[model samples]
Target: MEHTQDNGSVVYPDVKTDYHGHPNYFRVLIYLLVLLGLSLAVFEFNLPANVAIAIVFAVAVWKIGMVIRNFMHLRYEPILIWIAVFAAVFILLAFFWGVFPDVSMVHRELAPKL
Candidate 1:
């Protein structure tokens, strides 16, 4: 048996649903805007190359996490779903690492002449 809320989300019997009353979309938008502004500022600032790149990358990761958690609603998902998502990322990183050396040698003397 299930009961439906006004928001249309069904409440199942014995199932744990930690509904946080739905996130505020406007607040998430504001957060995204701030993160975007910070990322853009990294390009405008005269910081050192390594520092600027690191900051921009960090901002990008932060933005991705925020989007995933809030926009994609991943924060409300079960632990298994999170594990699957992380596993996919791990596979992608493994693939990238496996191919990275060959890609880096593309313009070097070790590269085969075609």
Candidate 2:
């Protein structure tokens, strides 16, 4: 919504303030806490390293999705915005993969003896 003042300048309302409905922040916090507990439990249970790592990674992704959807209000955003965000993440992943070989090999390469 826009409003015109006496001077005839158009004023736009803040998007944050124009929310139609807000998520239950307390509920979201509880969900996040539960996810944290699950992540920690993977360590406490002394599972195999591979299993533990997978569980932790899955929990981390779930927590991130919850925060992004609720706290960031991304659930209300358009599909185009979601596509853009995913594209950015894909680019970051591509960059990491491109650099991983050099980074991983650096530690293995030994200096020539004098």
Candidate 3:
């Protein structure tokens, strides 16, 4: 519980601002930078284009998880929030998966040039 002093000043609980003065945050930033570097460095290996794209996507998903858990403060959130986020992602993927076949499979040309 917070209380007001005789001088009419309130003492508040822990407050987070801008992530300044936080060593862990700086570490996370460094880690993210490293991930970014690695993702960029993927191009140097001369891997197949599809393999490179897969690696980039895997790295991207990991980076997104890290950013959400650390930077967005979602790690401290409740389980329900994680469920909601996953549910939303699942629905989005479902929609895209459902549309992919139709979009990518076409045997006919709609109209020829005049």
Give the top-scoring candidate (lDDT): 2
Q: Better model by lDDT, 1 or 2? A: 2
Ranking by TM-score: 3, 1, 2
Q: Which stretches of candidate 1 lie over 4 Å from their true place?
A: 1-21, 102-107
lDDT of 1 by residue, 1-114 (tens): 464544688766554644433466788889989998998888688999899999989988998998899778798777999999999999999999999988886877767767
How do all models score by TM-score?
0.72, 0.70, 0.72
Q: List the residue pairs that clash in candidate 3.
A: none
Q: What CA root-mean-square deviation does each model show from the true structure?
A: 5.5, 8.9, 8.0
Q: Which ten residues in a row are the worst by lDDT in model 2? A: 13-22
CA displacement after TM-score superposition, residue 76 of candidate 1 (Å): 0.7
Clashing pairs in 2: none
lDDT of 3 by residue, 1-114 (tens): 353534566665454533212226777888889999989999899999999999999989999988888778777567998899999999999999998887678545743445
